[model samples]
Target: MSEKSTVPGQFTLVLHSHLPWLAHHGRWPVGEEWLYQSWAATYLPVAKVLRNLAAEGRSHLLSLGITPVLAAQLDDPHCLSGMHHWLGNWKLRADEASMAGNTALGAHEHRLATEALDDFETRWRHGSSPVWRELIDAEAIELLGGPLAHPFQPLLDERLRTYQLHEGLADAQHRVGHTPAGIWAPECGFTPGMEKNYDAAGISHFMCDGPALRGDTSLGRPVWDSDTVVFGRDLHVSYRVWSPKSGYPGQPYYRDFHHYDHASGLKPARVTGKTVAGPDKAPYDPELAAAAIERDVADFVATVRERLFSESERIGRPALVVAAFDTELFGHWWHEGPQWLDQVLRALPEAGVTVGTLADARDRGYVGERVELADSSWGSGKDWRVWAGDQVADLVDLNTDIVRLALDTLDKMRADQDGLRDPVADQLLRETILTISSDWAFMVSKDSAAGYARDRAHEHAHAVREIASAISGGQLAKAQRLAAGWAAADGLFPALDARRLGPALGGNDESGGGSLRNHAGPRGRRMDAEGPR
Candidate 1:
């Protein structure tokens, strides 16, 4: 981390990279499309930036969180072949565009598609393990992990949460060759005693929203009474680049993510105006976008410099300013985001603003006093509303019902079979995990692909119900076929075992400490597993 002897403070850029399991699921409008688009647009370019900077002798560039489920897809055999085909199709589309006389769009897309294909072939064809492993080995970025499937821990059963987190950490270890001491806690959703869980799991630091600190995000705080540090995002700085109302991506020069040239499957328009119809938008110009990237990079560097100086003065010492964003927001949503990132990272060091990862900020003692964190998330209201709000009340009930039923069936079978390896129970557990994912509730609440989200949740729940029934009815052959079919579709974590979800390990009785199974509350909701316990 480069710094002036009397610098204002350390600045950390945290990018949370995550997506739900989308392997053998649908493709065109929702499932694998999301994965492949992000892989090509965001992952490839951002990784290239990090690798280039590492070659330039840069280390501790930023902190990146890749959830284990997304990691699984990035390394899955099915997804790799699918992505290869996607890239090939991208180039073919560009060729078609050229034949159709949109020469400029065709030329630009051809270059991008060819580069992406080469990068994928050379580095990513095998799997994402080597690609990320190289960066991890070089110390270019600190990798922060999260629970498998990105479950909303605050709403999960204690035993399930513990299993998910530990397994999530182990999965990352399996991929990158080291267990992460830090995590981007799913949804930033935290309960009070969850810090103790982090401590038990050996997680040293985690992140939360700015409001979790009551707006005091100048430094990382020790949560309650644990050494597990909680870093709250400096939303004032983060929102300056990408927020609900305004951000750099809204600039007229950037390529518009919404508008598409349907025939070629390429984005050919700039964000000419906020309310501009797709047909009215101007043609995207790479040169103009490059100029915008430079302008935004300068603005961001200046923002950090000003925030650091002002925060240092107010706090009476050098303070920490963390700007965290969804990694997908970069190249996927904002076409020039990778370029902007490259510039801002290099420019910050030159501007006398110290840049470092979350680990650097913590190890170098950019920490503050201990404070008790309340129920919070980086969601709509900085609370549990997004995942546990009224709009998702049905999902909450469905999750509760399936969890209890699956646990009951598994518990019965495990005791009867003396802890035998039951693939049916393993598939049962897998479906439940998939069913309870936070993405389903989030998408429904935000009205972004709500239909697909709801269908996925119900589909998994139905799987659990039918498999458990098959077992209880003594239909062993039918159960085997069902579990095998589901595993063929929802197959990501190869090491997940049904036997490992042994009791709560350590948690309140409501979440599997004892025999308190029927946890359905008013309107069939699960009351006990929520955050404020």
Candidate 2:
């Protein structure tokens, strides 16, 4: 522990990184652009920070939740090549900005773009698995896995939900050469008895929002009599650094995320004030931002120390404070976010506050008493409404039909001894997963890129319906053609073997804290028995 004699608890930083399947989809403003920007800005810089600390012997610095969907993009050859090109284009755009007389902003952009390009060419040219694997191998970070696509588990069919989780874990193993012991449940969404599924898949721990535990989130609790521990994110600490209304990122000094310079495609302004318009915002200065990062880092460290000490006293035991957020929040949304994160990681340990991964905190005996958590998520209202409410009822109905159709089609095919190895069946499953991604419902509810998100969901759903219809009607040619077309356009998860979906139906017990009899399915590695309660 890096804690001082006076510091009485632990702090774990958990970041959930995810993006929907964007490869070969649209580019600028929506699809691959989102992936490329996060890679160059967030992933590369954050990896460098961790690698630097790891070299200096910092262990378990944080828990990084890279959902399988994002991992697939990071390791995809097509995406890697595209990202390389994007970086080169970035540097060129910076040069263009310099030629246009915005010397200061251009020079900054040029330097950032050049360094990112150099970093990408030298190390990331091989893909990101190796970079992340280095951190994991060095024990500098614990990688958390999630479903194949980041589907809202609570709303998904139990059979498909288990399939997504198992396959997602397997995908992580295949890419990074290690199995994750924990997961960031998509949206931190969990239904009662879901822990049994986690137990069945050999997952040891997972995260939920603090409110889900009724605000008593000082320690990890065993859920539903299962040994799979669930840690709740401490919003008190998390919101101090970044939240909807208040946070360091919203400070006047940081670069404005929404105000863009359309000509050069750069953010040239600072967040002058909350009500400031894009055109009226002041110019950004690195020096101003650097000073703010220092101040913010010190403030955050003090806040964490105070919280940890108070919680330790109240709980009568060493408490654990888990602050979790979306990885994209750093760099992508707030340009100075990655720098602040680097400083925060360094400052906390120096300030006598223990900084470690969730696994480290748990292993140090931060476990709490068992509790039956209510059905909940970290979304608005701390419930499933964001994903399954009236606002997105169409998406909800579409997902329900997609799940039923796929299962019925698969069951019929298997009844005639046609197993899941068929290409049509594999592609059908892929479409189903794409349609149910939590991102769609989130986008619709927030009205941020809602049209694109809705269209994407419907497109995948239509594909599933068409493919399943072809399979059920015995139109093998039509089914294969439709599946092949989809495989060409929206294909992700190269390791997504449809056979891992298990016994399509009747597998979920649904009545108690027990999972399907066969969880790993054919062609999948069998999971170990659950830990004792």
Which residue pairs collide, candidate 1?
none
Model 2 TM-score (2 dp): 0.94
Q: Pick the candidate with the highest TM-score.
A: 1
Show the colliding residue pairs in model 2.
none
Give the alpha carbon lDDT tens digit for every residue of 398-513 in model 1: 88878778888888888788666778888999998999999998999899999999999999999999999999999989999999999999977989898988653454445343
- What tens-digit string does per-residue lDDT give for candidate 2 at 164-245? 9999999999989999999999999887878999999999999999998998889999998898999999999999978878
* Candidate 1: Cα lDDT at 494: 87
TM-score of each: 0.95, 0.94
Error of model 1, residue 448, in angstroms: 0.6
List CA RMSD, all candidates: 2.8, 6.0
The window of 10 residues in a row where model 1 has the poorest summed lDDT is: 516-525
